[model samples]
Target: MRVVVVGGGIAGVSAAWAFAAEPDGRPRGGVSVTLVEAEATLAHHTTGRSAAQLIENYGAQALRPLTTTSLPFFHEPPEGLTDAPLLTERALLTVGTVEQDEAIERTLAEGRLANPTITEIDGDEARRRAPLLAPTDGHRYVLEPESADIDVAGLHQAFVRGFRAAGGTIATVTRLDAARANGSGWRVETTTGPIDADIVVNAAGAWGDVVATAAGVEPVGLTPLRRTAFMVRSPWDHESAGWPLVADAEHTWYLKPDGAQFLCSPADETPSAPMDAKPEELDVAIAIERINSHTTLDIRTVASSWAGLRTFSPDRSMVLGPDPDHPGFVWCVGQGGTGIQTAPGAARCCASMALGEPLDERIDPGGLTVDRFR
Candidate 1:
């Protein structure tokens, strides 16, 4: 079988890699995979623009399993595939106010499901973890110690490398403009050339529906929400790093420590389309204001800022597997904010479905199926 995987982000790369590799002890040549990307390079969009943190129990209840199943891959990537580590020590601290105490309790309970390491830290403890946080506003805290910063680029490239080593083809700078149902398969037109495939995996991020329409498949009502992130100089001139990722318990804003700098986002989720995203001035200003109010890092200037789409289904859970009405047209989009954390398991699930095999039992198929949307 020949499979054409669309979108070269983390998802596409993982699917491609899995298809070419001997997944679940499946025999090789079960499927020939070809990954296509519109951008000149893979991961130039949401996958590349992620905050790159693994926070268990961070997304919807149904989606938590994907994040859970992905931990092993992040903690221990395949051997001989990477020259550098995929994860590093980092913590995610969710702070709450007096009025939000109930919500905080609920969040803490949820965090316990996938992260037993989660613990209630005192305000002083929270402050110690993130010294810049304002002491007065700190009312409650829950620390997800298992959460860590991910090497997104390395992970993405690892997939590409594995796919190529497995004899999978990668066509960059190629855009699928149209598709026709050719019997049981599809004939997709791309900028580079036409490709024939027995299956087309629509991992097209924000352009998922467009690919669906191209293939004469029903669109899943996928909506892309715009999220903006920026980098700023650390409050201290010296390396003021080692700060745990700090955020409002309600996710109003967040700041993660970077080398000699900080990555901050307002956690905004404005709706947008499939296009090159840009940072809005007001959004950046609002993020700065929120960060300043929550912490002692009174950053007045921004070093750089950019935006990316966090696409989601109507139910807010990922829509994986083949479309009910169109089995050959697979749905791999609608990852939302948890894409990076869940990519490993999500990609494996996608690969299993594409190859007509049972899902890896290790990967819990809770909120990852298309049946929910049906």
Candidate 2:
């Protein structure tokens, strides 16, 4: 069967990889996969603009299972697809103020559901983990030791390499204009050219609903939310590279070490129309102000910054599996901020539903499927 997967972000590439390979990483039989991206390169959007961390205790409860399912792939990827490890040691540390006592409790409770190893740490312990943090009287802390830094580019590249090795086609700078039912399959129109496929996977990041509408299907009501992240000079000791990612329990701001610089984000969730997102000046200013208020680093200037869309379904869970009304139209979108961490399992589920196969026993797949919304 010929399957065309839209969007070239991590999700698209991973979905293509899933369709091209068996669960055991062997090339599948009787399946032809084509991946199309509008940009000249893959992962030019949210996939590339993530915080690059794999924290199981994130996103909605429905998505935590995907994180669990994807752990093996991220921890031990297919051989020869990567030259370096896909993940590294980097703990997630969430701090809280007295005013946010409820938030801290909620985060602790939610975090434990995803990882039983999650535990609370005192302010002094948190300070040891991130010495740059300004000591506060009422500050509380929680640590997810299993959380680690994800090599986002490496993971995406691995998917691309594995898919290509399986004879899958990749079309860059190709935009899908429309799709229509042709016989028992689909005729997809694109800027690069037209193609016919037996199945279509809508992995389009922020433009998921757009892709669905173009295919003559009802929209899934995906809302693109803007999240801005920026890099600033390191203000701590050189060895501070081992510092855990420091974040507010309220999620107002977060900063993590990356080389000699630290990546900071306001964790803003402003609604926006689907498009190539750009960082807002106001958002950057807000992040700097918050980071300065909480940390010893007086971040006055930024080295670089970018914004990406974190699209979500109406209910805030991912929309996977085949459309109930149109089995040929499968959804692998609505990842929100969990896309990078959840890519592997999300892609696997997408391919399984598209090909009428069963997902692994570990993933329930019931909560994540498109039928949840129906």
For all candidates in order, the CA lDDT equals 0.85, 0.90
Quick one: best TM-score, which candidate? Answer: 2
Q: Could you report the Cα RMSD, in angstroms, for every candidate shown?
A: 1.8, 1.1
Q: Estimate, for each residue in 1-374, the C-alpha lDDT of model 2 and write its tens digit.
A: 99999999999999999999986678997999999999998988889899998888888887778889998998788876788989898999998899999999998999888888899999888888898889889788999998999999999999999998888999999999999988889999999889999899999999999999999988988999999999998966467788899899988999999988999999999999988899999999999999999999998889999999999998888999888888888899999989988999889988887787977776777778777777
TM-scores vs. true structure, each candidate: 0.96, 0.98
Flag regions of model 2 displaced more than 4 Å. Answer: none
- Model 1 shows how many backbone clashes? 0
Inter-residue clash pairs, candidate 2: none
Query: Positional deviation of 304 in candidate 1, in angstroms?
Result: 0.6
Clashes per candidate (backbone, < 3 Å):
0, 0
Q: Flag regions of model 1 displaced more than 4 Å.
A: 24-27, 237-239, 362-366
Report the C-alpha lDDT of model 1 over 223-272, residue by residue, as the tens digit. 99999999999866445677788888888899998988999999999999
